[model samples]
Target: MKRLKAAVIGCGAIAHNCHLPGFQKNKWCDLIAVADPSTENLKKAHEKFKIEKAYTDPLEMLETERPDAVTVCSPNKYHAEQAIAALNLGCHVLCEKPLCVSMKEANAIKKAADKAGTIFMVAFSNRLYKGNIVAKKALDAGKIGEPFMIRIRFAHEGPSPGWAMSDWFYNPEKAHGGALFDMGIHAIDLAAYYFGKITHINAMVGTLAKKIAMEDNAILQFRFASGKLGYAEVGWTSKQGFAGVEINGSDGALVVDYSDSVQLVTGSTNPSGKRVIRKKVIEKNPTAGGWPIEIDHFVDAIRKNKQPEMGLQAGIDSLRVALGAYDSDKKGKTIVVG
Candidate 1:
């Protein structure tokens, strides 16, 4: 097994929480460097991870280290530029979600990835969880029949305490669309990935939080190419928990409750005219280490000369869903997503 040298950019909650720890545990990776604009963040990451090479500039690290791959954990605004820079430098890049602040920038990064012949991917770690994967398997087994509606809910008490230090994530200029871009993108991508390409969207957004300028809540409805209807509700306003996703189809239904356990229903109908099925509490693994899969996947793509599972084009397609939702919110009309 070839161990790839990896560098992480934007040492914040995402870096500390997922990328660093994930890389630390992975035998296929050598966690080399980390870069952030904040000296405080860099010092903390270096100390915690015992990383020797820490810089305040990503480009500086890229030029000096020439890593085999890099993870861009920066604010939504910087995703495209930094990923493109890494790709141009002949390194595979694993970018965090939303892809970028806009579709134009998303396309730029995709083009750069294509031209450079390097792997570029967005770290959509939600799909890596056991519950999600199991749910997908059950659906494909025809347990869910023809998929119809998808109901998704992803929320947290708000950004973690670590987020206070990364205030740029809340700024409209930096984050593009607040909770919508932050938490909503994950649900959007996961839905599109399983249900198929999003063909249309209708959305409404509002800023309900006192401190945050961006929409703390959003409601979006999407039409998938496979003729599935989906609804996603997101909010930083939730005081309950993180999130969950439920898929309903004609023959049966699947519910992945992140709070409890993953459930599947099929076969005989109950009093409520719903199928009665089995539910299981598969051990809840840690989410903090999901980024390693994204890292390893990108590296494998680089080594094999193939596009990654969540390639640049997939990122672009996912971004369009959120962007279309935003457009719908602004124009108060449904938007067609290509």
Candidate 2:
């Protein structure tokens, strides 16, 4: 097998903790180059990963290395620009999610990916979770007959003082939006993945806890094209982190507590008119949260000469839903998504 030369476009936390290590672990990929404006981060990554080349400018690295694949781990504002550049350079791109800040940018990236004819995957890592996979499979297998509603909540203490590479996560201009774009994108994307395309979005976004210019918490309600109703709560200010999802169906319900396991419950009315709930742990072992699986998926798609499962359209769709939520909040009305 020919090892694909992979480059990372940012030296941030996502790049360091996820993309870089992911590339290193994949036998079919070679981590050849990395780029970031922060010399401190560049040096740290270079030393830690023992990468061959590092550049202050991503374009420069792309031009010089001409890698077979690239991961766009930059701030939200630079995702589209960097991903488009890599695609135009004939490199398969795995971009971190939220895709881009706006639909226009997302469309631009789509055009570039289409022209390049390379594997362009968005890194929506939540989809790779075992619990999510189990839920999707159960739902598809009709174990949960006619899933009617979905609820997802993802929250963590703000990104201000930790985790993120820098303060960019707190800056509206750089991060795009706040919790909605950061944590909510995952929930939005996952909702669409399970329920189908979101047709309508109504949301309330606010900066209730954090002092950031952008929203720190958001509550989003969505109606899917499949007639499924979904709701998501995302926050960067919570005493304890939380990640959980529930899908209610006619026959039963699938509940996923991402911190632990996935459960399926079926209820029926007994002869005495009392309801009986039968619960089972359909899936366990929820420790599989990382970038390696997603990265490997992208590489496998490239090698097979097939479009990635989470391709450009998925990214565009998720971004559209997110932007719709923002618009709905700003206009104080439900926004329709085509």
TM-score of each: 0.91, 0.96
Model 1, position 13, has a per-residue lDDT of: 86
Q: Write the per-residue lDDT of candidate 2 for residues 211-252, one digit (tens) a residue.
A: 779899999999999877999999999877558899999899
lDDT of 1: 0.81
lDDT of each: 0.81, 0.89
Off by over 4 Å in 1: 160-164, 267-289
Number of the top-ranking candidate, with TM-score as the measure: 2
Task: Please name the candidate that would achieve the greatest lDDT relative to the true structure.
Answer: 2
What lDDT score goes with residue 263 in model 2? Answer: 89
Q: How high a TM-score does candidate 2 get?
A: 0.96
Angstrom error at residue 155, model 2: 0.7
